[model samples]
Target chain A: MKIGVIGGGQLGRMLALAGTPLGMDFAFLDPAPDACAAALGEHIRADYGDQDHLRQLADEVDLVTFEFESVPAETVAFLSRFVPVYPSAEALRIARDRWFEKSMFKDLGIPTPAFADIQSQADLDAAVAAIGLPAVLKTRTLGYDGKGQKVLRSAADAADAFAELGSVPCLLEGFVPFTGEVSLIAVRARDGETRFYPLVHNTHESGILRLSVASDAHPLQALAEDYAGRVLDQLQYVGVLAFEFFEVDGGLKANEIAPRVHNSGHWTIEGARCSQFENHLRAVAGLPLGATTRRGETAMLNFIGTVPPVEKVVALADCHLHHYGKAFKDGRKVGHATLLCADRATLDQRIADVQALIDA
Target chain B: MKIGVIGGGQLGRMLALAGTPLGMDFAFLDPAPDACAAALGEHIRADYGDQDHLRQLADEVDLVTFEFESVPAETVAFLSRFVPVYPSAEALRIARDRWFEKSMFKDLGIPTPAFADIQSQADLDAAVAAIGLPAVLKTRTLGYDGKGQKVLRSAADAADAFAELGSVPCLLEGFVPFTGEVSLIAVRARDGETRFYPLVHNTHESGILRLSVASDAHPLQALAEDYAGRVLDQLQYVGVLAFEFFEVDGGLKANEIAPRVHNSGHWTIEGARCSQFENHLRAVAGLPLGATTRRGETAMLNFIGTVPPVEKVVALADCHLHHYGKAFKDGRKVGHATLLCADRATLDQRIADVQALIDA
Candidate 1:
């Protein structure tokens, strides 16, 4: 089957790579002819919002999906007229805006931090007063990797935060003081069968994800799966979805939903029974969902900005390095290294081994 | 670095897939535009024997490799003037002809079956007298998967056997009373580092590979590694290589050397720390070799001729199905399914599960 991916990025490249072994073909749609997915399949150089090009892609592929949520809902709806879009246009519409996504989580009885929509400077002030100090002001749309968001640590910070965002529609979320952050990599089939990978503990540096360690020790592992299951059922979601959460006090609080394969789940490629990319293809292809069994204690380290020297990384016995073919720039996710081991202790050692190399 | 592959079959397709994550690009040189690897990367529609096309490809890519040994050695030697041909044109020259390969193995002090080159009917008669009944007659070149070889059960079968092969340049071999067949998948790097994956016990049906199970229990496992290491050192080979061997009485006899990834090693996709394809790419790209550590007890079942229903194989928790997207024909390797388990018992059960599926 031919699949049309609306964005040409590392995610699309990975999905294309995963699809090849299954005899599935991919066509990447992007304005950048040098997009990484171009290395894997046919890259159609056109704007994502170009209706003519989108329709042309729809005409060629059996189904359509996107690697990024920033794609305009109108463009997705337009393509849906020609072919089925997995995860639905509705999911994309909700996920595109922070306000709508958080509201949906609240309505579904899923746990999320207290949040209020801010439309203007006055609204932002009112929201800060209600949510209290140390809140986060974020643009309602197009925010990722901690961009387009500002933390209001003091009342003085809130006044400049609204001006900083240029009066865009936004959200003021009450910060949840948490023990640690975790995410659930879940896939919901078209048949409504939902599967969850083991909970992954994630660490961030300067608001960018640095490491992800798959663990069964999260106190809310069962609760996280339950929360993800309810969300999947509520949205009638069909495809790989990731739900980020914060461990606040003794419970889990929803952080956000990524309705696609995520970075934290990258370890699945080497440490699970089936990779998230492959399973995502299987689900999108209408194939039966495979089991989500972790192969071992797994940890993944992002090779941000610069890839570590190969000699250092290769010395680790069970580590698998994946370098996404992209020009290296500061803070860019150019690649990743996944370490699979028999136990957490060994995995931790491997993590230290890689960390030392990165430091060097 | 860019690499040019001469064939666009599964081997080439896999090489392209492995090369992409390493920031290496590939151009497949094939006459058929729709070859499988064509979808994976840049594909140049050119005949392998065309000197102009071969030179263009050599000038375009950093290195050149062939997915199959059937390519004429003269074509490879011509390309080598402009680009490095890995495994060397000499390796292909030796491996393509049965008599040359067997003679080289014997001269190198490697154990091979007792055999003699046969170019005429008189030579065949002499070979029968020396090797006796139950011997095999095979073409000197261009044969695989039980093709181009016939067994002589009695003296009466010899005269017609010569006619059956169209009386091409051939070899007659005395069949060894072997207990089992095993293979070693090894990679020799440009830096002269050689790594070997664990020996895999293989079973064939109707001359087609039916099953492969990795075993550390094979008595000749170390011997196989030592033998393969010597071959790699002697050839100064670079890239993934495989050696097929027969376990006879108490020792191993070398059968053949495939200077590329072998089908029996497909289990490495899920059963080893680094897959043979990835290792081959690393070797050719001059990157450090990856770990050859086996993940666990593993088995691979070839999906020849047809793909069994997914339900039949999906029950095994760790079973991975790889469908190569080729049009199926009688005795064709359309795809394979690999099952990774914690122990031998689990692997046996998984194999039984797949066997039941094929039986059904």
Candidate 2:
């Protein structure tokens, strides 16, 4: 099968890596002349909205999927006319914008933090009045990795928020004072069958994800999957979907959704029966869902900006390194490492060793 | 590091697949215009002995290795003048010729079948007299997967053997009345660190391998590893090596060695902590030897001449399909599937199901 990917980043690179062994061919579309994934398969160096290239890709491949959530929904809708697109243009439309995603969650009866749409300074004031202080003010669309969002801690913060955020359509969400953050990678086949990976605890540094550790028996797993199932059913999703949630006072509250392969599930490459990348391909290709059994305790460390010396990483026992072949720039995720551990103690020790190497 | 490969067959394809995640680049040289692995790396379509192409490959890559044992030792020797090649020309020379390989085994105090050199019909007769009847006559070099050998069961069969085999440097081996056949995959790093995968029980039909099952606690494992260690030490071998053995009344007798990845070790792709392909790359790249711990019971089924429907194979739990992307012929190995089972009962059931599909 020939698969057309809409973004040529590490996620697309990994998707190709997983799909090649299954006898699937890939072609990727990205704006970068040297998208890192170009090495793995055909790279069409064209803008996502470039009609000629989009038509060329759609004409060549059996189907289309995107790695980047920010890929404009209209682009997917346009290509869907020529080729089937997974997760659907509607899913992208909802997922790319915060206001729509939260509204969808509320309509589906999924638990989420109190939120209100903000269209003007008066609307912002009303939102602050209704959602209260210490809320998150975010642009309605195109925000990721903690970008395009600010915290309104008080009245003074809210007064300057609209000017700071450029008076754009936005959302005011009451912050969930949580004990931890968790995310679920859920896969749904075209036949409506769904499977969720074990919930993972995520840690962030300076608003960027730094680590994710899978907890198969986390107390909130059932609640997390329940919340994710509603979103999947409402979206009628047909591929991998990542739903982030906050563990507030031991209860789950929906944070957001990413309609594509995600970083939290990267550990599955070495720690599960089927990797998230492979599962996503399997789902999008109309194949049976693979087993999602976790192999053991696994922790994934995201390498932002630079890939550490290969020797330091591979030398560690039970650790698998994935270098995405991306050009290094500050705050860009260039690679990741997944460590397999037999128990919590070993997991802790190896995590510390890898952390030391990354720090050095 | 950039790697130069001498043959772009399935083994080379797998090596590239395994190495790419390590951030290594590959260039392959093969005579076939449609060498399928070419799609995965830099492909230089040329004969293995083409010095110009070999020079170009050596000049461009950090190290060179060959997947096919039939790659001429002289080619490796010539390239060594420009860049390092693993499993040195000396190793290739010994491994390619049955006579020299057997001699090396004997010199290293390793047990092998009783054998003698055959020069002519007269020499064939003499070999029968010396090694006794029911012997096998095989060419000294460039033989694989049931090719280039003839078995003699009686005195009358001996008269036509030389005529059948034609004028060639050959050997007459008194066949061991063995109970079973097994092989070991061993690795030696540049630093002389050596590790061996557990001995695997192999079953062959018409000299082409049909199945390989890892027998972790096989009684002769120690004996097999010990025999393999002798060969590695004597040759100072680097990279992965295959040592096939014949089980005779609960003991082991050496058969032959392949100085590259072996089909019998394909199960390691999913069943070992470190795959043989990864270990081969690590050894050739001058890295530490990876842990060779077998993950669980693994059985690999070779898909000779045809690949069944992907759905049919993958439906079985823990089965991994590796399609080689080769053009199929009557006896060509197009791909393989590895089955990971938890116990004897589950293994048998899964094996029966997969075998039924293969037989179908």
Candidate 3:
């Protein structure tokens, strides 16, 4: 089988790595000629909107999937006309627009932060009056890793929010005060059979995920799965769907959803029964779903911007290092390390050791 | 760091997969341009004895290692003059010849089947008389997976055995009436740090490895490790070395050794804390040795000659499939499957399911 990935990043690179062992080939369409995953398989360097390249990819592969939700939904729709695309272009269309995503959450009776679409300054002011202070203003589409979003702490902050956001189409969402943030990765086959990995607690610094630890038996696991199940059923989704939620008063409030494989789930490569990458490929390739049971205590640390000394990382016991073979740049995710420990105590100690090294 | 490999086979393919995540680059020297591993990294399509290509590879890599023992020791010796090579050319020199390997085993007080060298038909007759009836004759070098060897069941069978082996220099050895076979994979670092994976019980059909199960607390574990430790110390090995032994009356008898990664150790990919491939790369790259604790009960099944339907294999729970991407041919190793289970019963059940598929 040949899989065509729409974005060539770490996730695509990992997908190729996982799929190759299953006797699957890959072709990636990306705008950057030097995308980190280009070395792994066929990489067609062209803009996501390049109809010619998208057509070429669709013509070559048996099916199509994407690494990130930022790829234009229209491109997916264009490819879907010629070949099968997993998770459906409708999933992409909804995930890219925060308004569509949040509205769908409300329509399905799933709890989410209060929000309203903002088309202009007047709309922003009206939303603030109804939703109250400390709300967040975000562009409805093409935003990720904390980009294209602004926080309104008070009425004074609301006046300039629209101007600061380049006056683009956006949405104003109420602040979700919670104790923690957890995300669940759920995979659905075409047959509608669904499964989920355990909820993983995530930590972010300046909008980029820096740490994620698999939380076995977290009190909110069932609630998170319930919310995710509602979304997957609503979309009749096929492939891995990641949903992030805020823990408010011991209940989950849906935050956002990514219609692709997620960074927070990377620990599955070595820490779970079946890796998310392989499972995603399985779903899109029409293979039976794999078990999602957690193996043991595990934690994943993202190596943003720069990779640490190879010898030091390799020296850490039970630590597995992954470098993306990417050029170093500030705030870029160059690599990550996954640690497998026998118990929570050992997992904590190993995470601390890695944390100290990264902080230094 | 860049590592150069001496052969391009499944072992080398796996080594590259393990090394890529460690930020290491690779360049392989093999005679086949269509080597299965060619897609993984730089492929130098040239004969093993091509000094110019060998020199180019040595110049590009920070260190050198190999995937198979059939690679000539002199080729390794020649490359050593340009770059550092692991397992030492001396280790390969002794391992490639049956007479030298048996002598060294005897010198180290390791028990092996009684054997004698045959120079001619007269030598074969005299050796059979000395070693006893029901003996086996094999070439001194370049034989694997039941090739280039024959057996003498009795006086009537002795006449044709010499003629069957192309009249090459041979070794006549007594047959070991052992209960079973097992193999050990051990890694040693430049700093003298050593670690061992748990021994694996092996099943072979017509001398081709068919199945291997990680046997925890097997009665002969310590004896196998002790024997392997002697060889590592003697060679002062700096990478993974594999030792096969025949289980005789709950004890162990030494068989031949492989100076590189062995097929029987493929189970370690998902069965151990760190795989044998990663450990080999760590040793050659001068990194710390990883923990060898078994994850759980596991079994590996080798796919020979052809591959079964991929979807059927992927449907098996907790079963991981691997394909070498080589054109299938009779008697060729095409791939393998590793099944991880929580207990012996579950492991056996899963292995039986996969076994039925391969047998069909």
In order, what DockQ does each candidate have?
A: 0.63, 0.67, 0.71
B127-157, model 2: which lDDT tens digit per residue?
A: 8999997889999987789788998999988
Each model's RMSD to truth, in Å?
Answer: 1.6, 1.6, 1.6
What shift in Å separates residue A23 of candidate 3 from its native position after superposition?
1.3
Off by over 4 Å in 2: none
B290-350: candidate 3 lDDT, tens digit per residue = 8887889998999999988898998898799988888899889999999988888999999
TM-scores of the candidates in the order shown: 0.97, 0.97, 0.97
Candidate 3 docks with a DockQ of 0.71
Cα error of candidate 2 at position B94, Å: 0.9
Q: In terms of DockQ, which candidate is strongest? A: 3
Off by over 4 Å in 3: none
* Model 3 error, position B299 (Å): 1.2
Tens digits of per-residue lDDT, candidate 1, B1-360, equal 788998987888877777777777888899985687888877888888888888889889999888988898889889889988887888788878999889988988889888999989899999899888899899999989999999899988898787789889999999999999999999999999999999999999978899999886566878898889888888889999899999988899999998888899999988888889889888887888987778889989998888786545554577887767777788888888898888889899889888877777
Report lDDT (CA) for all predictions.
0.87, 0.89, 0.90
